[model samples]
Target: MVFKLTSVLALVAALAVTGNAQRQIQGITFAWNPDTPNGSHNLPKNALAMAPISDLNSKAFTCRTNGLNFPNIKSYSSTGGEMFIVAWDMNALNSTDGPKLNGPCNHWMASTAAGTDNLKWFRIGEVGYSAEEGWCTDKIRREGQLVVSMPNDLLPGEYIFRNEVIDLTYAGKTYTDDPTMGAQFYADCLKYTYSGGKNPKEVTTGLVSLPGAYLATDKGLLLNLTADGKPPGGKYTVPGPALHKQPNPGSA
Candidate 1:
């Protein structure tokens, strides 16, 4: 589902004309500080300012050509475990449909290329609906500090760390008539370069494309928060290609 620029512009225009209220959704602005050389002491003050446009397609967002600017590739060691954390801003504006939905379901992925336009992406991890808590409550609980780790065996190269949150609270029968079918997506792409891994083989399987990577009808995308017959133990099948298994950090 490649979204054309005109289509995106049209959607934005429609939202503007309809006077849709914007909800404040969380976003990932910083890489794991501990993995960086100087930690938080040297991190940028306004990381979100460097982020690409928040939209359905990851490639539509901007990328630093020089790869040395603010929010550029933050180096991490493949041997040592590291993670990227979402820096939430309670004040950031989002679609009104988000809060009405069932979740802050987190979807995280990595790609060897810089932009998501026609790029092959690999799923890293996902946190979907939980059965222990009710719908609205779960959304609020998952809104803070969403985190995902870089595979320890990832081949060293320039890569984009893509973090996405899907709100499905409005996915039930009541919202079937809604143009978006009550699905809201918030995505962020951060630049990164991995080094110090023993494996030299590149990961080639389990590749998927963004926009096309997810379908609104996918069970994980359109969920019934209050239904008792949901997947056992609330386990979710994230809507994307299977996670590519890279070799362990020290593997030959």
Candidate 2:
């Protein structure tokens, strides 16, 4: 009886650990160099709070940078060799929302000045429902990190890198009006100063706003992943302005 009780206890402990592991995602923070002058990256005070649909245009629950200089500001090589590492936390009961079986779609963008104003931003790149992240799978999986490279000819100036992840599993709840079905939006901005570009043009053209950038009925945001047929059976269109064209540093 004693041996049987011990085995049962061990099995229970193993299951508990597995449950906890599934809740957490990896790379929710920027990977800064330890040798750099800037310290570790810090999330805004209200980073964990959820922003309502109405406040999408405004800097609703973004990092509260009141009177604070840019934290985790870093420099990047203009020759197009460097890559930015973006991460997120996805434990359901934790701060940010968890990934749905079909999604956790990602949209990354950038702007010159700092502020939550959507009008000042443009698309850099985006990743829609991905099979690598276990989209549409039966088990709970974490979509944690991404690596992004800037255009070689990117202008030299102060810029803000904005990363947005939309949880579409619970989307469509509100439908056409405010289709956020229980959808959750997670976003973070990192600051940077660039130099050494060959033909750096200002990124004022093709600007897009956050709330204005997406609609409730956008194909990528409102689709039902669990339907009997194959999930997202067509070319996935990332909602927003066209990708800005950058000159090649090598061409200069």
Candidate 3:
């Protein structure tokens, strides 16, 4: 689903008028079902709170609510090549009390039994700033969801997937004034079993831990979304490990 510039501008104008409020991940769908029944797959641990993690060094940066052992949350069945759609509550754009997401979108995955090794969580991909298309959050606000592709080359095993959005609307500031005057980190994870894949990578290189992945002063975090107005394109670097690539069949 693509949106035009006129429509995109309209959304930005509306969001500007409505004001900002932190929103939460409502639920996740295994496939590309935007209208899928709401609550079919359980909500994220912090769905009711609707708060963003300001401190990037805390354990909550790992999974928002649960640390390593995220138990009792409902698990879903997923196969490689399927679409994972993360649905957000309607207030993201409709109500005046929703978030104005103006930052990057990132997702990661790790083996369920990978122990405490932070390097096991490999970055899948990231969608960041675009001079012509606007921020990734713009797309999310337009559709009210963030869609990611399940890694097709991943080994068949129990895995946890995380979808995250960094709200940079106030990233250029610090907590000196208001505690909330900084970048907002919102992340959620879901457990799933994989059945089809061609790789058995347990600990891939370049993986990074969530709590240690970002810093308060990282160039990506301390950014002015308005400074780079009309661009040949802004120099917005995504903060995290490099995007994961499947190792060759028998090389690693």
Candidate 4:
């Protein structure tokens, strides 16, 4: 009887640890890096709203238990530079489904980290935002007085990827919360103006990671780290540095 009791206790303890570990990953938070609209356009300086996305267990969405299992992304090149796989598959939850950005700004495609004076954006996925972090450690340069945005028609706008979402069943109550459904992405977007780089890109941080064999995907950048249940910025691999350049105004 004593041996049997000990075995039962061990099994219960193992289950408890497994359950707790699962919840730890479920609790993921995200941050928005803010910036202004244009240079003379008086764009805000490093602006962000703080989306704080927490994807708790919701039987409604029917998301993969192994977290968001994104499909293999695709990439292409055109006048718009290079459009990499922004998201695996996406479905909006509501009107603000596009960007899911911080502050009130949502619609954007490419953004820099230095500041917003040289920020540029495009349209893909939805309007606002998704889990995908736009333009990772990237470079953007602007010279002309003209505000550099997009093609002959693409305007500087921000929207969210919100559509076909349902209420999250939390604590026995259906919360009509909108979290953009799509595979996360990261971009290596670059912008250089005629004047070269009088304008600087914006820089900011987003989202918190969890412990254990971790994984992250953004456009072309992918990171696989082990937190061992540690806090943010805890010993991690140093993937090759971000894209860099020295604006050759002489080429002008």
TM-score per candidate, chains pooled:
0.60, 0.62, 0.74, 0.18
Candidate 2: tens digits of C-alpha lDDT, residues 93-154: 23234443344444344544555343367767666544443442222233234545565566
Residue lDDT tens for model 4, 52-137: 22233332121222332222111111222211111111111112333331211111233323353333232222221222331111
Q: Write the per-residue lDDT of candidate 1 for residues 27-87, one digit (tens) a residue.
A: 3322434323432222233433322222333344322122313355454333323544444
Candidate 1's displacement at residue 97, Å, is: 11
**Quick one: best lDDT, which candidate?**
3
**Model 3 spans > 4 angstroms off:** 1-22, 32-49, 66-75, 116-119, 174-178, 227-235, 246-252
Model 3 earns a TM-score of 0.74
Weakest 10 consecutive residues of candidate 4 by summed lDDT: 138-147
* Model 2 TM-score, 2 decimals: 0.62
Candidate 1: the clashing residue pairs are: 23-94, 59-116, 101-169, 101-170, 102-168, 102-169
Cα miss at 211, model 4 (Å)? 26
The residue ranges of model 4 lying beyond 4 angstroms of the native Cα positions read 1-47, 51-135, 138-149, 153-252
Worst 10 residues of 2 by lDDT: 23-32
- lDDT values, one for every candidate: 0.46, 0.45, 0.63, 0.20
